[model samples]
Structures are given as structure tokens and as C-alpha cells.
Target: MSGLKRLLKKGLGLGDMAFSAGGGAINWFPGHMAAATRAIRNRLKLSDLVLEVRDARIPLSSANSDLQPLLSAKRRVVALNKKDLANPNIMHKWSGYFERCKQDCIAINAHSKGSVKKLLELVEFKLKEVICREPTLLVMVVGVPNVGKSALINSIHQIAQSQFPVQEKMKRAAVGPLPGVTQDISGFKIAQKPSIYVLDTPGVLVPSISDIETGLKLALAGSVKDSVVGEERIAQYLLAVLDTRGTPLHWKHLNNRRAEGVEYDVEENHIYNLKNLKPKRRNNPSNRCDLVYVEDLVMEVQWALHSTLTEFNGNVEDESDLESLIDLQFGALQKALKIPHKASEARLMVSKKFLTLFRTGKLGPFILDDVPDHTPVS
Candidate 1:
């Protein structure tokens, strides 16, 4: 462990100031992350209110635990983004959930002004305590990477008509806390009447891997591949729910396929119809369809898995194809297989690489469509 520490130190060449500033002797802090933490702390001093942005779907997961303590003295406003993508009823429930914590909660679509208006209102309300002392409002915006934090800032400023012009205009661009910047701090000025200043911080995350898990669960519940755990688990869980809901195929289509002999028009009946027509047990749609939207889901998952595998760049690329197995039509199959309730593991199984690969843009945004998984196995 000490060797790892020394190697890290030598590798990063942390300036003597970092070691002396009582930042605490961190034995294993990744260089980029350590700088980001320092940047966050420094930025906290220049701001009065903290605007924490989180994915509306997974608000808790997206909260920046690393910056939590730093925000102890400041007013905190939690902004939930991508409300349009979340389950609406759940979104309301979550808003109430955060209100109980003394946190100002607002749901917004980062891409639209309507979604953020409520957020601006909440920020002004939270800043009431310090608004009197400084005519210029200093609210710091923070969130984890790729959670649309940057987009949120851009959208807010655009709508406000330069009321919250970026810190660059205030000559405090050097004061903001993001690690990549060489300047000290960034500040903003409000352009219009409901005056407020805004500072944007790069997304931050907790030190532990479990933090990422929590964050992933909230943001990826609907969009993930399947319910394995965390993002994937929730994704799988949604798939199971969609299964019960009889999704993908409208009821009309289901009936039409059953009435007619069109294989694609029907739902799960393709398996049975194909079997009935064969001299041997074969797949050919004759006239009846048995399954519902769940079959199409299976095909989608199968296609996603295949595309993920074929695109893998690691040793997995040279590995033999995964043998066709039973369909994982329910989210429970992930648990039954004893796979970790983790999106990372499922990602590796599907894409054959570490989870970071997916984050770093090495693998996906996998494409999936209504395609059958089996074709006579020939």
C-alpha cells in the first residue's frame, strides 16, 4: 500500500504546496480527483449558496458526497435534471422526499426553460439569508460528470438573458473551483431584476465505488440495459416491469398478429407457431402467437448483448462467442444467475470490459431494435 502511495506521488509530482496545505496525506488519491477536491473546496469560499444538480431519475446517486461536507455552511439547493425522462409520479414523490431534508428541491428539463424556472425560484429562496449582504449573488452549481450539469448552466444563463452571465464576464473566471482551470475562482453577475450570481463547478463524486452505484441507480433506472443492480439492475428491473405491462407491442398489434399469420405482427407466439409447422421442432409462425411484448424485449436485449460483444476491443474480442442460453426475459434472471447486482458486471459480460470503458466512451450507446434472437441455430 505504501509503495502504491509513493508511486502515485512520484507519478503525479504533486507540488510541495499540496502536501503542506494540511490537505491530509492521501496515500491513494488519484491525481485528477485530488485536484478536483481541492478545487471544490477553494470554490466553496467564493460562493454563498450551493446549487447541486442531480439526475432526476437518480437524485441521491448523483449527489456529490465529496462536496457534501464542504457545503455544510452554505445553503444547498438540489436541482433534478431530465425530468422528462423520469417516471413522473415518482418524480413528484422524490421532490417531496428531498423537501423533508431541508433541501430546496426543483425538477427541471435541462434542455428547456420551463423545467429550470422553478429551479431559479428555489435558488433565490435559498439565497435569502445572504442576499442582503451582497448585491451580487454567488451560487455555485455542482454535480457529477455527464449528468448534464454543464448543459444546465448553459441553459439557465441563456434563458436569464445574461442575468447570470458566466464568471468570465465578471473577471472572476480564475476563481471558480474546477480542477482543470489554472485561474483561482469564477463569479457571475445577474443581468435582470431577480438578481443572482452563478458559479458552475465540474461534476464531483464520492471517493468510494459504492457512491457511483447509488448515483447510477437513480439516473439509469429507466435507460439501463436490465436490472442487475445499480444502473443495469434497475434497467433490468424496468424491463421486467415493461414485461408485465405488456409493453413494446400495442394490444391492437398483439391481437392482429394472433388473428393473422404474420410472424412480425404477433408477439411471443412466433416460437409456438414455428414449432407447430416444423417436421422437427422448428421456428415458423403459422397462425397463432403466444407471448406478448416480453418476447420483443428478449430480442432487444439479445441484440444489445451481441453488438456489445462484437464491438469489444479487449481480450474478450478474441474469446469464443457466448453460447446461446435461456432467455433472460425477467430482471430476476440477473439475480438467478448470481451475477452481481451491478451494471459494471453486466457491462463486462455484455461488452467484455471494465465499467469505466462505458463511461470513458470506449464502448457504447448500444443500438437495439425489434430483432429475434434465435434463427434455427444454423
Candidate 2:
């Protein structure tokens, strides 16, 4: 653990500072999760195969450690969801890491049939022998909250309906952008020939996370609620990560090659809302901006981060210095995102909108988890 911490500090800059300094105090484990864990374990005994879904951006952190022992013992496939929102170059390295651990891993975008089809094929291949002999088979899909388990099940239901028509009216699994949308385990009949059922379980996490960094990753990746972790802290962590990896520095050259050809209209005068609406947890589709609007905003944010890091003279290893840099960034981001100077909650507004852009993949693709060198495989 010490070695991993040193490597992460050297590479990504999550140093010795505790996340509690961010001023968020909330329960990590709710009562609902306590019951969900026991239910999932009981169902695992009846499941013939398990689709262990994880956030592609935080692949390792998203795994439910409490259930990993039983999950890995059964026939399982680690399905990394929301791959479209993850860094394409780093995903293969993660896949290789899983392969070394002897796990069948696939990066998938639940909304894409093309990607989901490949996963279904893999599941069939794994259960080829049982398909012929068993009269019934249960396929359970489980994950931490907001990892897109519901979306995947809905897609699978559509595919099944196409393959085998049903006379009774069927309902799709409830899908939402927030965590813990599905409260109970619901089974969908995918096939009638052999009575294959797909179980969609409520997202569950262990009572306590192993580390502060893991909790932060889960919060950033949407496995945990922003209110619990506090949006400001998550945004601070995001800035720290971008700063440590020199991500913003690389963005400078990305558009510098086109610096001579492109220009923005000064008279456009388009003001997009950077409202800090606490009521709405998800990015509203109705308020979505045009491509030109979003592109310009992203450019502003990248330049803001790049300029701040480029001008500062401080030690990245010192947690105090990093926190001071983060404070400066909140001011810079408020200006970049065009939030009103006099806004009462300017910092909170900047944090929420900034997080939305990253979560929606508007700023750029990112993978928060670094591949481990070695670990015990269950």
C-alpha cells in the first residue's frame, strides 16, 4: 500500500493530505446499502453468470470489495461501462491488466448495441455448456450506483424482444442519471426457449471504503453522490489530477497547431448559464448549449488551467501548496465559465458546471484509476 501511495503521489499527486479538509461531513454508508448487500449475496447463489459492471474511468475503485470474493468465485465478466467517457489510449492498458489477473474484461458503452452485442456473445460463450443442459439460467448484473447497470439491462431487454417476441407487455428498467435509482432487484426475461432471466440489482457499496482516495474517485465517477462528497472537493481533486499529469499543459499545443487558422467572433455575445442549481443533480437536456458554445467554453477552461499551472512556482508534493493552487483555480474557473463576478456561491457554481462538463465528456476523456502492478486476484 505504501508503494502504491508513493507511485500515485509521484504520478497523479494525491499526496498525504486527507479529503476531510475539504469540509464535507456526511454518512458514507446509508441504511439501504446494508440491506442491498445481503440481497445481492443471496441472489448470487442462484445466478449462473454475473456481469460485474464498473465505471470505465475508475475501473478498480468502482469494484464493490464486499462482494468481490463471491462475485469472482462465480462465473463472471468484468464489464467496464461508459467507455466512451474514458480515455481510449489508457483503456487497453487496463484490459491488459485484467487479462494478467485472468479475468474476462470488456470495455462497453451501454447505449451502443454494437458494443453490448459483443458482451452478450462473450456471456453465451462462457455458458455454452450450461445452455443446453439447464432448463433455467439466471444472469445477474450488479455494480456501484450510477455505473449504467440499468441502461445496459434496458438495452439487453430490447435485444431480447427482437430475438424472441413476447405477447405480454414488458416494461423497461428504470434509468436515471442519479445514483440508487433502482431500489430492488428486478428480473427481466430475455429468452423463453430455455427461460433465461436477467437480474438488475440495486447498486451497492461496502459499509466503509478502503481509503480516502478511493472514496474521492467513486464520488468523481458518480458511483457516490456529489452532495455527500461535496462538489467543491471533487472539483479540487479533479484540478489536482489535471495539474499533476500536466494535462492542461498538453492542451496548449493541441490547439496551437490550429492557432493560425481559427478565431472566435467577438460580437457573438452568447452567455450560457453557469447556474448552481442544487435541486437538479443531472445536466438538463433542455438547457444544453450548441456545439460552438460548448467548444468555446472548453477552450476557455483548458487555457485557464494551463495558464495557472504554467505561472505558479511551488512544490506539487506539498499538500498546502496544492490546496492554494486549487483556491486560485476556483477564481480562474469562475471567470472562464462566465459566472457572474458577484454571484453569492461563485465557487460552488463553478464546481457544479465544471463537473458536469467533465462527466458528460465535453472537456475531454479521462481515466482516473491507475493500473496496479500487482494484486491478489479473487
Specify the highest-lDDT model's number: 2
> lDDT tens string, model 2, 148-184?
9999998888888888876344687788777888888
Root mean square deviation (Cα) for candidate 2: 4.5
Q: Name the regions of candidate 1 deviating beyond 4 angstroms.
A: 1-30, 162-187, 192-195, 211-378
Displacement of residue 80 (Cα, Å) in model 1 is 1.1
**TM-score, per-candidate, Cα-based:** 0.51, 0.88
Q: How high a TM-score does candidate 2 get? A: 0.88
Q: What does candidate 1 score in Cα RMSD to the true structure? A: 17.0
Residue 206 Cα positional deviation in candidate 2, in Å, after optimal superposition: 1.0
Top candidate, metric TM-score: 2
Residue 258 in model 2: lDDT: 43
Off by over 4 Å in 2: 1-26, 261-271, 274-289, 375-377
Write one digit per residue (lDDT tens) for candidate 1, span 1-378.
Answer: 332123222321222312222222312234555566788788778777888777665666555566776775677877777666555656666666665565577888776777777787777777767776776667787766556666677667666655444434322222121223321234455544435677766444455433222322433322221222233333332332233233333333333443565455564233322222222223644333333333443334434343333343332111111111112332334442234666665532432211222222222221111112332221
| Worst lDDT 10-window in candidate 2 | 17-26
Look at candidate 2 and tell me the lDDT of residue 340: 90
